[model samples]
Target: MASVSMKDVALAAGVSQPAVSYAYNRPSKLSQAQREHILEVAASLGYPGPNVLGRSLRSGKIGAIGLMMMDKLSLAFADPCTIALLRGISEVGELENVALTLFPLNNNRLVGRSPAANHGSLALRGLVDGLIISTLPDDHPAVLAVVKQNIPFVVIDSPLVDDSFFVGIDDRGAARTQMQHLLDLGHRKIGVIIDRLNPDGYRGPIDPQRFKSASERIVRERLTGYVEAASAAGLAFEDLSIIEAGGLDSTSGQAAAFTLLTSNDVTAVVACSDVMAIACMKTAHALNRNVPQTLSVIGFDDIPEAVQLGLTTIGQPMVEKGVYAARMLTEQLNAPAGTRLEPEQKIFATKLIVRTSTLKI
Candidate 1:
């Protein structure tokens, strides 16, 4: 096949080389009729216009961004909460005409690929102009690789990175509110379930010392809030048991629930997510333990399924967080080369939505 060049289009349209270039890239430099004629001639010659690589190299921008996550893309989308966040991100990406690339480090393992192997490729290949980390731990290998590469990134709901933008909810205050609800109901025997204590999915009773990692910032903050609220009520950490779920899904929630229910006499349970709360409710139902009667459950993230199941949950603006994070990244990308913008910490508020899943115990 013969390759069509700008020279061919210029000769066919009777325009200079610069005029042909202007017609495709700098259209304002040419009259409307001249630009239309040049495009029509280029179409006739089977020219597909300039290569993306050529355009990107000339502009010093890729017109795209990458989103990093440790979980599989399929599992990430399964949760409506994550779907909401993706929706917000796509909304801005569509409006700004930017593409989004997902990097799920764990799934790549099946094909003998590791995030470390790809991290270097991303830098050398220029896969994206910027990056957004959804929920990597503070010291995650992927996070470390990105930091080492000095890529522009925003951390969402994880360890607060120095000189990096962060977007998250006031998890501690929100957890305290939910814990107070259960505590106010005369339920001192409360249990807590965290989706992740460490990146390894270590389930079972979490050691008190294990809660100090910045990687578990969200979990630590929420537990701290619960402890503070309990202390204000003249209660101690010994009054409750804390367990880490096996995974981020409902099965993990079920396991955590069983351990808490069988091991202790908890009248109420607080889960870190509505998905986990739903799983605990199912486990309770299977065990013939009536909800709000034998056990009351409260979860974070008021996902659509939570409303359908009448689950009492904490509502956070997942979509808004995504939107704000993407906007900050875009702003950073558009900033002057040497301009320094102070890192911004944006915290969204959470609300307690009372539903059938929780009640006075």
Candidate 2:
């Protein structure tokens, strides 16, 4: 097929080559009539509009943002929190006509690997003008991959790099606040369930020594929050068993809860996520334990299901986090080339939602 060119359109429309280019690249340069005539003539010549590849090459942008998460693509979508976050990002993408591409990377693929061993992230080169990565250690391979790319990016569920944008809630603070609720309810023997303790993807009770030396920032932070609150109330950290569910979702939560409920004589359970809380509730039900009466349960991230169950939880602005992060990226992207962007670290607030699932015992 003979691909139509701007020159052909210019010839048909009796305009200069620059005028044809202006019609597409800078429409304001030409009068409306001239722009209309150029469009009409281009249509007559079967010439498509501006070439994407050529424009991207000349403009140094691909009009897309990449969202890289540490999970399988299918699995990332399974969590309601992930969905809510993506919902916010997509809203910005739609408004700006920018594509939001998912780069679902497994733990082995993204973290703890050398930058040279980061094969997965290298694939992102030239794929997106910006990246929004979630939850990695400061020295994670995925984070290194983003650093090497040297593009505008926003960090979520993790710490911010210098001169980059970071959007996340105060996980430690939220965890402390949520755990305090359980403590205030007069629950002395409480259990804590976590998705995972480290990037190694290990499941089970994390050894105290290993937990102390662990690099899993998210897990460590939340656990610290719990311990801090409990300790402040004169409760020893050793009194509570922190169970690593080893995966993301209600199933892992349920399995972990099974161990805690079956063995431990706990009065309440604090799940790090809504899914885990749901699992705890299910486990309590299967064991015939009445909720909020025998085992008061609390969760984080007031997702739709949590609300439906009237579960006491901590509500983070999931969608708003995504929205604001994308908007921050958009600002840096829209800035003139060579303009340095300062680091923007934003921590959204998390609220406690009192519901039927939690009760003063």
- Each model's backbone clash number: 0, 0
- Candidate 2 residue pairs in backbone clash: none
lDDT per residue for candidate 1 within 200-251, as digits (tens), equals: 7678887667777536677778888888998899887777688888578777
TM-score of each: 0.78, 0.81
Task: Give candidate 1's whole-model lDDT.
Answer: 0.77
Worst 10 residues of 2 by lDDT: 49-58
lDDT at 186, model 1: 81
- Model 2: runs farther than 4 Å from truth? 1-58, 93-96, 107-112, 119-122
- Residue 105, candidate 1: how far off, in angstroms? 3.1
As for candidate 1, its clashing pairs are: none
Candidate 2 lDDT tens digits, 215-267: 66776788889999999998887888779898887888899999999989989
**TM-score of model 2 vs. true structure:** 0.81
